[model samples]
Target: MHSPEIDNMAKLWDLIGDIRLAMFTTRHHNGHLHSRPMTTQNSRADHDTKLWFFMSRHGSPVAELTGEASVNVAYANPGKDTYVSVSGNATVVDDVAKKRQLWSKSAEAWFPGGPTDPDLALVRVDITHAHFWDVHENKLVQLFEMGKAAVTGHPAPKLGRQGEVRMA
Candidate 1:
């Protein structure tokens, strides 16, 4: 069996590799969570981080961020049986240079006018922490815990506490 730390890291790596889309949740002015589907723009292994999207200077999401920067981003891959939720603060970046760097042909499908569109805005969420559950592996772990419980009469391992990390 792998050490807990190694197993957790492997799960996280697998989760990111398997998930291609993420749902971004931001707080509306009235305090309800507003969620929208966002394509996974990029993932940086060095930081164990991922970036989701937005049109640079417009949308209710950008406006909401101006007032409250806290947000939640989630990813799921049913085929891989993995899920992740990241909580962090988002900042609006209008750097033309960054816009140029991240621009791609695929983005044109949504933003017809391209990256130069005046309304295009970027919301960069610097992930502060995250929680993940790998149902594929956790199921086996759960079975083990259940068998142990039947023999020793102890409670099974708690559900949904598979792996997590806090950014420094």
Candidate 2:
């Protein structure tokens, strides 16, 4: 990746690092979309577009993706006013290395047998593009900008940044 692309990917992580949970959405065979909150298994420092999550082997998400691989993962931080949407292809991964690598005690709540649990499966989403809105300003600054825009009858100043990242 070029410096600019690296920078953009880093920025994408910055917007999502503080948000641990993502609304992982998948399309069912019935043509309806379903979403569930899933915890990200990697940190921002990973610096990769691929995301991982642990799920039951027979879970609805696994079944849904087995039929349809396209998926979306959404991150939102209302307190920070940051939001991100990632589109990608997801699949039920069968990598024992990855399972042991990401395994933790917290996950035992769902997988009592730990990494060797037959019901445990890893879902990997290879992101194709990501759209993010990062508004890092404080409430005071945002209100001031909105006030100025209102007074001048002009659009509010976009103190933050928004853009798309194409990883594939």
Highest TM-score, which number?
A: 2
> Candidate 2 deviates by what RMSD?
2.1
Tens-digit per-residue lDDT, 33-115, candidate 1 = 99988765554543244354655465888888988999998988766566888888988876666666667788778777777
Q: Which sections of candidate 2 miss by over 4 Å?
A: 1-5, 43-45, 147-153
Candidate 2, residue 48: how far the Cα is off, in Å: 1.3
Clashing pairs in 1: 55-121, 56-120, 56-121, 56-122, 57-120, 57-121
After superposing candidate 1 on the true structure, give the runs of residues whose Cα lies further than 4 Å from its correct spot.
Answer: 1-14, 43-52, 137-161
lDDT per residue for candidate 2 within 105-134, as digits (tens), equals 788998999888999989999988899887
Candidates in order have lDDT scores of: 0.72, 0.87
Error of 1 at 72 (Å): 0.2
Compared to the true structure, candidate 1 yields what TM-score?
A: 0.74
Top candidate (lDDT): 2
